[model samples]
Structures are given as structure tokens and as C-alpha cells.
Target chain A: MKGIIYGLVFFVSLFCSSFAVAIASKPIVVASTTQIADFARQVAGDRLIVKCVLAPGADPHTYQPTPDDVQMVLESDICLENGLHLEGKNWMSTLATDAGKPIITTTDGIKPLAISSEGEMVADPHAWFSPKNVAVYVNNIVKGFSQLDPDGKQNYEARATLFLQQLRVLDSWVRQQINRIPTQRRILVTTHDAFNYFCTEFKLNANNNFLSIAPVGWSTGAEVGGGMTPERRRKVVQSIKESGAPALFVETTINPKQIREIAKETGVKIGGELYSDSMGPEGSAGETYIGMMRENVLLMVNALK
Target chain B: MRFLLVVTIWVVIVGGLWGYIADRDTRRQQITAATPMDLSVEGRFVIEVTPTFSTEKDPFALTTSDSSVPPLTVKLNGMYIDTHTQEVLRGQTLRYEDVSGVLSGHNEIYVSASPPLSENTLEHGVRVKLYEDSTLVVDQTVWADQGALVSGTISFNHSADEEGSHDH
Candidate 1:
């Protein structure tokens, strides 16, 4: 009887401890991608428990809503999403709908550009890539946090103010980086339509076949919808040659084979990797939005200049 | 013992079903709530490009709407202006709440209190112009790092440069 009583007490203590930890945890704010989660964290400060559904290097285009993701949304206070049809069409709305949380579309306020490649007006979701669009995102995030946790509204606003300062520094740094590349060599080439806002903000043209300004909705796994044959590869090579871009770049998610082939064919070096559609892994250089932009500018300067 | 077993089973099954139903209902309600109030609003304000005087909690107010319509559960209201005031706001607080959200978006509610003129004016207390399909809502604060509003060619830049600074 004494042993039974001792066991009950021990179990109860363990249960109580577990419960205490869970209760002590802050409300989670989940974003669809790392770039957003980073921004949310900046605005939310210590008050919010923030995370992204798409892990580093994971493509946001094909991000399937996992059961765990749904559960996370269900439990989280807010879900930040890039709403220019950024999270593909299917997974995002479902997750937002399932979670019942206020899914904040960060790019809702701005007049988004309909960057076209062929005839169709391709949707560009890479607004966060550009500091300008990110301003809109930062605002939306602050608003979301304020609504969800009004008690910490003051803190959210204060932190957002500070983060904006850092972002301003980052923008000037990017402009400086672009200035490094001679005007003639100011051509940005990368995977997919991720850098449209970046190009628009920085005055660079998105004229690469491999990298379309519009959301063509192609993952690196497939050859941009269909297979990229030798002929299609020839066009990319020819464009790079005619444009005289100082460098051609590959994205973190895409395998570097196609871009490498284009570079080899065109005698241009592949200018490292760009954080398109997603941020870098935790502890990496391009992990946060500002860090990602800083790293991108640094890479662009080193490659083009 | 048999009755107790039946009761426990009934409770468990019924409770699980109820939980599922309740969760579904909750998500639907949230979506429905967001769906109706798709009305867009835009508010604009101009601050001194470089305020020598400290703006610690300076009331840069844009009197838009008084809180209305179940408060609409304000989504976001960050500001993205263009200027060189980045250095000015260091170590300062920029607190915005329900009043802040209304001031940024929803100008119709408080248009009466707003300055008489309908253009960007300082003494006019941030003149506002409304659009039926289109509106301008700039209450969110974005840094020079990521402050660009894409409307035709109007880049908010969120900078305080003299050229970028339009008369508010």
C-alpha cells in the first residue's frame, strides 16, 4: 500500500511538471515560410512564440499541408502568409481554413504587379524578397500581432519600429551593392519568379529564361512544367550571352545542373545561390529576411562587381 | 459495473465527436468572419523628413474612423513611408492600437473630424481621399530595408527624403 501511494505521488508530480511546462509556453505564431516567421518574430519580440511551416530550403510552391502543420495552425495565435497566390493555391487556404486562426495576408495592401512571361499574367508572390513589399508585410504582421495579442500591442509596435530601421539600412546596403555592378551589368537571373520585387525595387531587369519574373509555378524537380530539352537550354544560354550579364545565379531549392549548363555554355560563372521563395536554415547567413537580403546583396556585389 | 462501462464509452465517443464538430464550426466561423469585411481602406500621413526634436511618442494622429462594426478585428496597420528619418527613431517607441488601426484605414468614420481639405496637408490633419474599389491604407511601419509600396510607379520607399516627401 505504501509503494502504491509512493508511485501515485511520483506519477502526479511528473504529470504536474509536464502540465506546467506546456502551460508556461507562449502562444505560437506560425508563418508559411522562414522569411515571414523571421519578420513576425521581429515584430512579436519575446511575447510571441514564432515558427514557419516550410522548413529551410523547402519550396513554398509545393508546400503540402502536413497533419502536423494543420495542428500547429489550429493551436497558433496567427498564421502569416504571402497572399499573391504565393503558397500555390491549394495548401495555404486549406491550412488557413482548418486552423481557424487569422491568416494574415502580408501583401494585401500593396498594388502587386502582374509580371508576365508569355501571355498570361503570372502572379508574383515573392513580395517579401523586395524591401519595399516587405514594408507592407511588416505592417500587416504588426497589425496581426496587435489584434491577436492586444496586451502586447505596445511591445509589438516598439519592436516593429526598431526592425524597420534595420530594414532601411538593409535597403541602402542593397542599393549600394547594385551600384557596385556597372549599369551595363545590372542584370539579375535566378530560378522561378521569386526576385520580381527585388528587381523592380533595385532597377534590375528579370530577362532570364531560366528565371521568369512571373509565377510560372514550376519547381526545380520538374523542368519548369515540362522537361528542359537542349533547345530550351540554348535560349537561356543565348539570352545570357546577348544580355552580357556579369553573372548567372542558381536558387537554394533548385539543383544547379541547368544553370551550370547554361553558365558553361555561355562562359559565365554561376554566382553562388540566392534565397528564393524561402529563407536559409537556422544558424545560416540568409536565415532571417534582413539577413537574407544582406547575404543576397553581398553575393550580388561579389558576383557582378 | 456494466452501466458504468456503457456510460464511459458513451462519454468518450460523444465527447470525441463533439470536439471534432466544434473544431469544424470554429474554423468555418473564422473564415466567414474574414470573408464579409473585404472592404479596403487607405490612410496617409506625412512626418517631417528629419525631426531635430525628439518624437518620443509624438502623436502623429490621422483621425479616420471611430471604432465601429464589432471592431472588425483589425488585421494589420503598419506604416511604410519614404524618408531619411531612420536614424531619428532609434530607442523611441511607436505604439499603435485600435485607434491607430482606424486612423490608418477606415477614414470614412472620422472624415468629419479630419481637416477640411482633401489633399495631403499638415495643418489639415492628414487630408484623406477615398476610392470606391481602391483605397490607400499606410499605417504599418516598414524599414528602409523593406519599404516599397507597388502602385504604378509610386514607391513609398518609406524614406523621409525631401524629394520623396510629399506635403501632408
Candidate 2:
């Protein structure tokens, strides 16, 4: 009887250990940016572990992946990235490719704005400026998560639907707020050309040639002021002078010296600091993507109105 | 009676050990053999305008006309798989989830425009990429004139080990 009791204990322990392992195991999902990670968490919930490579307030366009990021990718079951060269030097792509992990580009289905840099037209990578575009991001994320874990399809879809409804409400609210400002006063002058999608969606451009006039170009690479050439500067100054923009605004990720100078040159007061390249830091009003966009629009309306 | 009891206890011990080892091996095999259940297909389409006049005469004509012209768009009219049909605009990326059992050896994607564009209205091209899990399997580009129906085929076995082929 004693030997039998010991054998039964051993069997029960082994069975319990396997069960514990099964319960604790969850797929790891690594997102390239905070915004993408937030979206993944909304859809993934408790089904997967979501991690972000770029922390809040980190500029995606100039971010570099560390060796730790490579190890994280290797261990991750799936990786998500905002393609369209948003990772500056394509560091996210390089990390995922090197680690042989599956990667989903969150901006896979959104229509991008074409901005001219050095007389060459390039697709603007900042699609999340508009809530409608973020809806597309949510959809792609749902598909990615469902593919990674088919058993969680219903869970992801349900969460995505709820989030998408919130986005629609946000879009409607933005339109209503912007409507308060006069059509001619809808011009948004920022440091970089990141608000083209916002301008296009809200009909805020003065003309097709100049959509959301800015001192800097679309990206902040090795090029001076993100390819802000002398000609481009002259054009922006001319546009501001012609349009008589009410105010100029700076971004969260970029330095405000250049925009401040532009404001001084144009004699326009700095409206407010807007979240551009990256969202606001934790514990702030603009910490989440939705919060960031709402704060930006409110600031724009109050400044431009 | 003592001999029988000892033998029964030994049998129980041996059986428990054997069962534990077999279960561990089975679980290991299950983990090693697991494959992804879906593949990602992503691509973009662009519409190009072909001018009927010379550059000097119409240097600003295209620009002026484009200003009057509405935003040009395209749609995914159909796919060989029934569930994958959806609309995609020009200059926008399209990503389709090709789940297991929904895709087969050969698949076709058909594109069409609403209200039918004229032959000289615009020219369009498509670039598609297929990925099995994270590994790129195939990439191809196809072009067609305005008002012409555009279609492309992607071929691959359902097996996770096989790479897909994109025929333009």
C-alpha cells in the first residue's frame, strides 16, 4: 500500500506539471512601435503577450533596433510593424527578417498621401494621423492575430469591432470640432509634413499644391531638417505668407527651434505642441493613440479658430 | 499474498513511468510539428495616366486636368477563393488573410473599376507579395491598360514547407 501511494503521487505530480505548463504558455507578439503595440493589446487581450520595440515618445523614423530587440524577435511568435519605411532605416524589417519571424505591416491597406521631396514624389508614411486610417490598422491587426492563433479569432474580432466603433465616434467628433473653424482658417502649419492625411481628411489644405504647409519634409533622416531644402523653405514661407496662416505648431518628437524660427519669420504665434511623430509619454493625456489624436485636434481647433 | 502485492506495486510503478515518458515525447513532437495555419498576401496597385499630347503643349495640362479629375480608385472584384473578395483603392496596399484550407494549388485575383474607365483614362499596375508565415515566398508585378480587366495568379501547395509562385 505504501509503494502504491508513492507511485500515485508521482503520476499526479507529472500530470499537474504538464497542465501548469499548458496554462502558462502564451504566444509572444512584438510590435515595432507603441501605437501598434497598443492596437495589438486591444485585440489580443490575454491571449498573447504584446511588447513594443519603440517606447512611447521614441521617434519611429529615427529609431534603431538593439541586439536585445533581435533576441526578442527570435523568441516572439509574431511581429508587427508599420511598413512604408516608417522604421527610418528599416530596422524593424531587418530585425524580423533576421530572426526568421512572421511580420505583419499594420499599414497594409491604407491609402497613403504622396508628398514631393527633392522634386520626387514619395508616399507619406504617417497614416495614423486620421482615425479612418487607424481603422484599417485595427483590421490588419485583427487578421494578423487571428492568423497567429486561430482559436482566438472570435475574441479578436469582438474586440476589434468595439475598438473600431470607438474610432468611428472619434472621427465624427473630429469633424464636428473642425467644422467650428472657418474653412479658410483650416490650414495646419506644423514642423514636419506629417499631417497630410489629417489635412486631406478634414479639407484643411489651402490648395492641392500645398497640403498642410510645414518647414520640414516628410522624414527626418540624415538630410538637414528632414530634407527641408532652401527651395522648400522658400516655398513654405511663400505659402504661409500667401495663406496668412493663423498659427504655427511643433511636434512632440521633433525639436521646436526650426518651427519657432518659422513662426517668428512668419509673425505667427506658436499655437501649441502637437503630438506628431510619436504619441505623448505615459501618464499624459495623449498617452494612447486615440487620446493623442483627440488632444491634437482640440489644440488645432483652439489655435486656428 | 505478499508476493502478489509486491508484483502489483511494481507493475503500477513501471506503468506510471512509461506513461509519463510517452506523454512527454508526444508533447514534444506536437510542439515541433506545429505549423502556421495562415499566410499573408500583401501588395499595392497604382494608376498612371498616359498623355495623348506632347509635353510642351500639355506641360501643365495633366496637372490642371488631374485637379478636375476625381480621386482615381480600384477594387478587388473577385478572387478564386470566395471569401477573399474586397475592394482596394489605387496607391493603397492590400493585405488578404489566406487561411489554411481556403487556398489551394492555384489562385486568381481579379480587379475591376466602377463605372468603367476609358482606354485613355488611365493605366494601372499591381505588385503582389506572398508570405508563408514570416518568410517571403513570391513577389510579382502585373500591368494593364485602363478599361482592361486585370488578373493575376498565385500558385502553391497547402503544405507549410512549399513556396508560392506568383504569375503575372
Candidate 3:
């Protein structure tokens, strides 16, 4: 009877140990934003556990990291952030650095658009606006995952390749859609200056004017209600009038009130909201990176064309 | 009999613990062996643009004409790789190391000049050098003004040894 008891104990211990090892084997990936988390998931698949610091639709520019964020970083094997000062006060970097965790900047390789704000030139952190830049983000994510879990290199690379193919198709499709709109009417006005890369990629800025004509500058960190200066407002208004823009757009992560006012002032209807700073909530059409880009383009073409 | 029972229980526990630890270590070793080292691409980009007078009667009338010298910018795989706004009278060389977005297969690099590389610009061109593991893999140059776009692809076959050693 004692022998049987010992045998059962041994089997249970073995099972429990195996379970622990299985659970611990998968690396933990902590991403600073929901968009970064989505990219990580695409590359990591089941190889890593991806956690996002900012929830969907959360304003990253003003987000403050909680104590739990610190703990999460401590347990994370890798942390990914959409660098270029997108994390407001650099909370993500601070957390990762404090925990000695490896941090990967998803925007590391992409050329950032520079915007002049309040007499300072700042790099726009919204590179994900362009599908081409998202490809860069995907590549960086794959590299980061492979480094963290070298055993999963092939897996990461495979997923990245598949996703990149989709992006290439998406890029061509975006071009086709944008081309439907006449060159003269290809103006895209939004609430903030987040669409520079998108416009540049699609050739919407045909005149080479650096104005993505928005009430807000490159960042929302400016004082409340102070982001839209008289100069910016006048420029946006002038651009809208000169370009004969048909419609305007707001963003998911910002208040629609400002854009609505602009629309009212310009006599151009609010075309629709675009997923800018953050992607849409889960189960929505704009949830994934590709979906968000597609939806934004569809809205633009439908409205502008 | 009690002592015997105690010894048996202790032996069972020890065996169980030992088996658990050994299993974990084996799994770890398997993972370590299976893990593949990360691969990255590094290279240098050089651009040389020579000012040229336009054949047009009025150079300022050309829409592409700029009074000030335009900056040289480059894009890799449709994304901006670098933008040198500072004037380069003779030429400029830019080095990129451990660029993370490089794939195991084909990669594209594009070079362009702002204010548009005009036809009149003489001796304006771009040179690209790609390296893998510190070994030169690609050395090519294309005239920038001829196309206003100089592009190339560098292919990396990382699993060459496993498939049969090959260089690209």
C-alpha cells in the first residue's frame, strides 16, 4: 500500500514539474502600446506572452505608468516601445531600464518625419500610419523576439514574412485606392499632425509642402487647449481654403470637438474618424495594424474621391 | 518496519525531486540548442551630387528647380532610411550598422535626392555596400539623377549550411 502511495506521489510531482517548465518556457513580452502588442502577437504567435501597457484607445502621450507596470516590466523578458518620444514622459523606457529588461524600439529603423512645434523640431512617432513603416515595425519585432527566444527564430521569421506579404499587397492596394482621387484633391486634413508619413507615402502631399495641416502639432503634450495655436489654426484654415479640401478627419485617441469646429469653420464635413494614435478596440474593423490602415484608406478614398 | 517505511518514503521523494530537476535541465538544454542566433544586416550608403547648370533659358522657371541646394535622402524598402539635410559640397557617406529590419531573404534599398535629382546634375550618383558577418556581400552604384531613384536588393541565405552552403 505504501509503495502505491509513493508511486502516485512520484507521478503527481512529475506532472506538476512538467507543467511548471512548460509555463516558464514561453518568454514574456511587454509592449508599451496596444499597437505594438498587436505587432508582437503577430510575430510571436504562441511563442511569447504579449502584454500591452496602454489599453486600446488610451492616450499614450499622457499615460502614466502605474506600480503594476513596474512589476510587469520586472517579469518581462523583453519590452517593446514605439520610441521617438511617443511615450509622453518616457515612462516605458524608465520602467524597462529600472528592471534591467531588454527594450526594443519598434521605430528604430524608420525615417521619422520632423515637425516644427513651438520653435522646436520634433520627430513624429506615428510611423505606423504608413504601411511601409509598419513593415519596419514588424521586422523589428521579429528581431526582438528572435533575440529573446533564439529557438523561435524560424517561427518568428516565418510569421513576419507572411505578414510582410500582406503589407505589400496592402501597399499596392492603398496606392490604387489613392490614385482614384485626382491629384489636385488628394488633400488629407486631420485633427493632429499624425498623417505626414501616410500622406508622403501616398503622394497626397504632391506640392512638397510639409504641412499636414492640423490644429494640433506633432504631440498632444502641449498645454490643454493650447496645442492649437493661432498660427497653426490659420495655417490649417489657409491650407483647407487653398486646397479646396472636401472633408476633414478626427482621430480615435483625440476629442472630435476640435476637428468638428474646424470642419464647421472650413465648411467641409467631417469625413470620418481615423485610427491615429491608437488602433480600434478588439473585434472592431480597425483592430489590427493592417485593418486600421485599410479602414483609414477606405474612409479617405470614399470621402475624398 | 517503521524505519523501513520512513526510508522508502524518503527515497521516493528524492527520486521524484531528482527526476523533476533532470527533466527541467534536459528541456532547457533542448531549448538552448534549438534557439537560433539573431541575424542583422549592416551597410554603408554614399551619395555624390554635382551641381549642374540647366539647359533651360530660365533655370528658376522650372518647377523642379530650387534656389537652394536640396538635401539628399534615402529610403530602404519604401521607408526613409536617412535624410541628410546638411549640404554636401563634394559628397557624403553614411554608415548603417546592425540595421534590425533586414530579413533572411531579399532586402531592398532605395536612394533619392530632394528637389528631385535633375537631369542637368552632373556626376550625381549613389553607392551602396552591404555586409554580412563583417564580410562584403554587395558593392554597387547607380546614377541618382538618371532615374531620380537608385535601388538594389541584397539577399541573405542564413540557412545555407543546413541546405548546402551557398552565398548570395
Instruction: Tell me the TM-score of each prediction against the true structure.
Output: 0.60, 0.59, 0.61
Report every candidate's CA lDDT. Answer: 0.59, 0.67, 0.70
> What lDDT tens digits, residue by residue, belong to model 2 across residues A46-95?
88999889877778887878888888999999999989888988889889
RMSD in order of candidates: 16.0, 16.5, 13.3
The digit string of per-residue lDDT tens for model 3 on B55-136 reads 1111111111134322555555556666555654434456665544553444566554432322323344556665556655
Give the lDDT of residue A151 in candidate 3: 86
Ranking by DockQ: 1, 3, 2
User: Per-prediction DockQ, in order?
Assistant: 0.03, 0.02, 0.03
lDDT of 3: 0.70
Which one is best on lDDT?
A: 3
Native-to-model Cα distance after best TM-score fit, residue A115 in candidate 3, in Å:
1.8
lDDT of 1 by residue, A1-305 (tens): 45445555655676799887886677788888888888888888777789788999987776678888888888887788877777866476678777677788888777776766456886667777666567668878878877787788778877776676566556656776677787766677665657767787777764543234321233343353347766666666676676666777888877677667667877978788988877898899888887888888888888887
Lowest lDDT block of 10, candidate 2 chain B: B55-64
Q: What is the TM-score of chain A alone in each candidate?
A: 0.86, 0.86, 0.88
Off by over 4 Å in 1: A1-25, A206-226, B1-168
Worst 10 residues of 1 chain A by lDDT: A209-218
If ranked by TM-score, best first, what sequence of candidates would result? 3, 1, 2
